[model samples]
Target: MIVVGVDGLRPGVLAVEWAAREAVVRAVPLRLVNVVPAWCLHDGPTGAVADIGAWMRNGGKSALAEAAAAARRVVGTVAVETSLLGGDPRRELIEVSEDADLLVVGDSGMGALRGLLVGSVALGVAGHAHCDVVVVRASAAGPRPEVVVGVDGSAAQTAVLDFAFREAAVRDAELRAVTAWNWRDPLGGPEASERALAEALAGRREIFPDVRVRTEVVEGSPVDVLRHAAAQAGLLVVGSRGRGVLAGMVLGSVSQALLHVAPCPLVVVRGR
Candidate 1:
């Protein structure tokens, strides 16, 4: 199933709509989830506190209802399910990711303030989720028929290629695999990057022969290269960590940076 977190916010509704369309393409069920903060509920049995808790629960249910309706509007015959959860939003969503094929959330969560590029919940879950996590953002140019992916000869390269190809095939979009070459690195030049990109995607073409692919090796920062390439793409897919990132880090610096600036929805695939 595709699980999407909805808070009734504009970005949250966009996430639901994206997930609904993805469900239809993948032929899976869509699950809309709204999580009430634990702080809203009280341990004591005070009447006022009880009333406030009830109000919060009701609000969460209403949000779920609206999310379900929005999903149905996107695809009326989609199998959609709604859930009202109570706990830490990040933890709850991460747990939900275990059973989900894809877990999606809005780039900005509720209580978003000016200058806050990405929401804490979205970042938290993206870094810790057990499965792939997609952070949805509205693109200025609207949806395009292309999926861009970052390719580095890292241990996670295979998984990243698999995801990029699958997504391209499902969306019937072009797959653009990009590799960034650092000029300072003598051993790994543009030529090396190109070879790595080709080798990483060697057999994926056969698996997804229908997906039109274009590969490039540009010399620059990984984040900057990918951000420009995905300016008009429908989706941007990358591994949780890149070759340059330390293994101890749950989220690579490049992936984290792109999450804040990528033009389209970004999917962080966990390395298996």
Candidate 2:
């Protein structure tokens, strides 16, 4: 099933809509989840504390109902479910991700402080979730027909390619496979970048014959190149780790950078 976090904000609403369409394309159930802080559930010495707890719960329920309605409006036949969870949003979402095929969350939060970039919960879940995490953002323009993916010549490229190709096929969009090489590095050039991309994509085209792929090898930072390409893409996909990332790192610098700057929804395909 596909799971999405709901917070009664525009980004959250958009996330639900995106997840609903994805559910229809994948023929899976869509689960809408709303998380309440664990502290909100406790009854303090003051009676007002209990009232505040009740208020939070009511708000959560309302948000879930609205999200569910929005999702149904996207596709009436889609199987949509709602869950009201309590605890830390990051922890709850990571646990939920264990059972979900995909986990989606809004790029930002409700208020000014949280609205700056990606919310803390979204970033945390993206780093630790058991399944692929998609940080959904509001598309600035109309429907985009291209899906961009960053191939870093890492072992995780397999998962990145698989996810990118599947997403492109499901959306009936073109897949643009991009590889970037830093110009300042003596060992790196266009030829090396092309060779890495070719090696990674070898024979994978046969698995996704219907997907139309355009490979690009550019000289620049991976994050910079991928961010530029994502301007015209509906979705930007990347692996959690890249060739330059250390084995102990959970989320690579490139993936984290794009999560904040990608103009489209960013999918971090974690190695399983």
Candidate 2: list runs displaced more than 4 Å.
42-46, 109-112, 184-187
The Cα local distance difference test for each model comes to: 0.86, 0.86
lDDT of 2 by residue, 177-255 (tens): 9988877754478887788788888788898899999999887888899988888788999998877687678789998
- Candidate 1 residues lying further than 4 Å off, grouped into runs, are 39-44, 110-114, 140-142
Candidate 1, RMSD to the unseen true structure: 1.8
- Candidate 1 lDDT, tens digit per residue, 1-272? 99998888888888999899999999999988888867665466568877888888889999999999999999998999998887978888888888999999988865456678888888898899988989897544236889999987777888988999999998899999998888775447888878877888888888898999999999888899999999888889999988868757989998899879989889999943
lDDT of model 2, residue 27: 96
Give each model a TM-score. 0.94, 0.94
Question: Which ten residues in a row are the worst by lDDT in model 2?
Answer: 109-118
